[model samples]
Target chain A: MRSAFEWVDALPSSIALRESLNAYPTLLTTHVVSMCLFAGLIAFWDMRLVGLTLRKVPVSNIPTRLFPWALTGYGINLITGGLLLYSQPMRYYDNFYFWAKMALMAVAGFNMLWFHYATYKSVQAWDQGREIPMSARLAGVVSLVLWAGVVVTGRMMAYAGLMPEWWNNLNIGA
Target chain B: MTQSFFEWMQGLSFSAWMLEETWASPIIQCMHLLALVAFAGAVLVVDMRLLGRGLIKTSTARLARELDRWMIWSFVALFVTGAPQVLSTALKQYYSPFFWWKMQIIVIGLVFTFTIRRRVAFAEEGTLGHWPKVVGVLSIGIWTSVSVWARLIGLLS
Candidate 1:
C-alpha cells in the first residue's frame, strides 16, 4: 500500500505553479540574497538582546525598525526555498540531512515569534530604553545558536546524500 | 603573473603538504564555515544600527564606531584564513565560477563599506540620521549576497 508520503511524492507539479525554478540562475541568485538578508537582520536583534551596542536604543524601536525589513527577508526566503523544494521534491524528501535542516529552521522561526511576544515585548515596556532583562538575553542566545545551526545544517545537507555504492560521490566537488 | 606567484606558493613544501592531507581539507572547510557566521553575525548588528533601525539610543556614529572595533577583526580573521587557502588552490579556484563571482561581490562590498564609512564617520551629529540607515540597508544587502553565494558554491558545485 502506498503511504500518504508516497502519494505526495508521486504527485506531479502543476503547470501554472511557477514551473519549479525555470530560471535556475535567477532562483539561485534570489535564494542567496534572501539567506544573507536573514543573517543581517537577526544579528541586529540578537546583539541588542545580548546587551551590545543597541543597549542605548529604545527597546520598542528595535521591533518597529527591523521587523519590516526582517519580514521582507523572510518573504524572500520563503519564496526561494519553496521553489527549490518543489523543483526537486524527491531528492530532498528522502534525504535525512534535508529534514534535519528543515527541523532546525522551523524551530528557529517558531522560537523567534514566541520570544517576541513572550519576552521582548515585556522587556521593552518595563525597561523602556535600558538594557534588556535576563529572559531576553537567554532567548537571544538560543535564537542565535538555533539560527546558526540552521545555516550550518543547511550547508552540510548539500554534501550529504545517500546513494548506492556504484553511484557515490555526492560530496565530491567537480 | 598571478598564476606564477600562486604556483610558486603552491610549490612550497608546506603548501603542497597542506593540500595533500585528507583531514586538512575538512578542517579548512569547517573553518571557512565558522568565519562565515562570525563575519555575517557581527556585520549584521552594525548594519542594523547604521540603518537606524533605532537599534541604539546612542548616535549612529557611536554605534558605527563600536561596530568598527569588532568588525575589523572578524573580517581580518576571515580574510587571513581564507586568502592562503585560495592562494594554495588558485589555479583550480580561478577556474571556478563560484570563486570569481564571490570575489567580485567581496571586492565590491568592501569598497562600498569603506566609502560610506569615511563619510559616515565625519558627518555632523544629526546629519547622520538618514545616511547611516542607508549604509545599514546596503551593507545587509551586499553582505547577504556574498554569504549566500558562498553557500550556493557548495550546493551548485
Candidate 2:
C-alpha cells in the first residue's frame, strides 16, 4: 500500500503540479468555487426537506430542480479533488483530516441512500403543504451536518496541520 | 489614512482577544462559512427561478417575495460575522490585494442583488423581455465572483 502511494506521488503529472507555483492555488480556489455550488445547493435543499426554509415549495420539486447544479458542482470537485490528491498523494494518504472527510462523506452517502429508498418513496403524499415525516427530517439534518463536517475537516487539513509528520516524500520532485 | 485605521483596529481589546484565543478564529470561520451557505443558497435559488430554470412552480414575484426575508436575514448574518473577522486581521488584510478585491466585489454584488435582481424578480412575467434574462445571467456571474474572491482571501493571505 505504501509503495503504491509512493508510486503515484512520484508520477510525472504529480511532479509537474507540485513544481508549478500557481497550480495548487488555482486548484484550491476552484475547489472552493465548486463547494459554493455543491454544498451551497445541498444545504438549501436539505433545509427545505427539514422544513426550515422554502416551506411553501413542495419537497419533491427541489431534488428535480437542484440536482443538476449539485451534480455539476460535485463533478467539478471530483476532478479538482483528484488532481489535488495526485499532487500530494502521500500527504493526503496519511492525513487524519482527510480520513475524517472520507468518513463524513460515507455517512452522507448512506444518508442520501436511506432518504431515497425509505423516506422519499412517500414524498408525494407529504411533499406539499404538509409536515415532513420525522424520519425524512432526520435524514435532512444528518446530510447537512455531515456535509458541514466534510467542509470543516477539509479546511482544517491545512490550518490544523492535521497532515501526518511521518508522511515524508510529500514533495516527490524533491 | 487606511493604515492608521487598521493600526487602531489592531490595537482594540476585542481584536487582541480574537487574535489571542486559539478557538476564536476557527469558530468565527465556521460562522462565516455558514452564513455563506445560507446567503448563497437563497440567492442561487431565486436566480435560477428568474432564469426560468428552477423547479419552483410559483410565480416569480411570489417566489421572490417568499425568499426575500431569508436572503436578507442571511445577508445580515454575513455582514455581522464578516466585519469582525476582517477587523481582527485588519493590518494583514489592509495590504492584501485579495482582501481589497473581495471587498470591492462584495459591495458590487450587494448593489446588484438589491437593484437589478430585485427589480427583475418583481417584474411582470411576460413583460420583462430580455432585461431579466440579462440580469439573471449577470447575477449568477457576479455572485460566483463574490464567493470565489471571498474564499481566496484566506488562501492569498
Maximum-DockQ candidate: 2
TM-score of chain A of each: 0.77, 0.90
Clashes of 2: 0
Encode model 2's per-residue lDDT on A1-174: one tens digit a residue.
Answer: 668879998999899998888888889888877887788889988988888878888888888888899889989988998899889888777677777898998889899998999899999889886689999888989999999998888776675443445543463223
**Model 1 global lDDT (CA atoms, 0 to 1):** 0.65
Q: Which digits, one per residue and each the tens of the lDDT, describe model 2 over residues B52-155?
A: 88755877787788778878998899888888887798988888888888789878988988888898889888797877778878888887887777777776
Off by over 4 Å in 1: A1-22, A129-131, A161-174, B8-58, B84-89, B97-101, B125-157
Clashes of each: 6, 0
Each model's TM-score, in the order given?
Answer: 0.74, 0.91
**C-alpha local distance difference test of each model:** 0.65, 0.82
Q: Pick the candidate with the highest lDDT.
A: 2
Which pairs of residues collide in candidate 1?
A36-B144, A56-B57, A57-B56, A57-B57, B50-B132, B51-B133
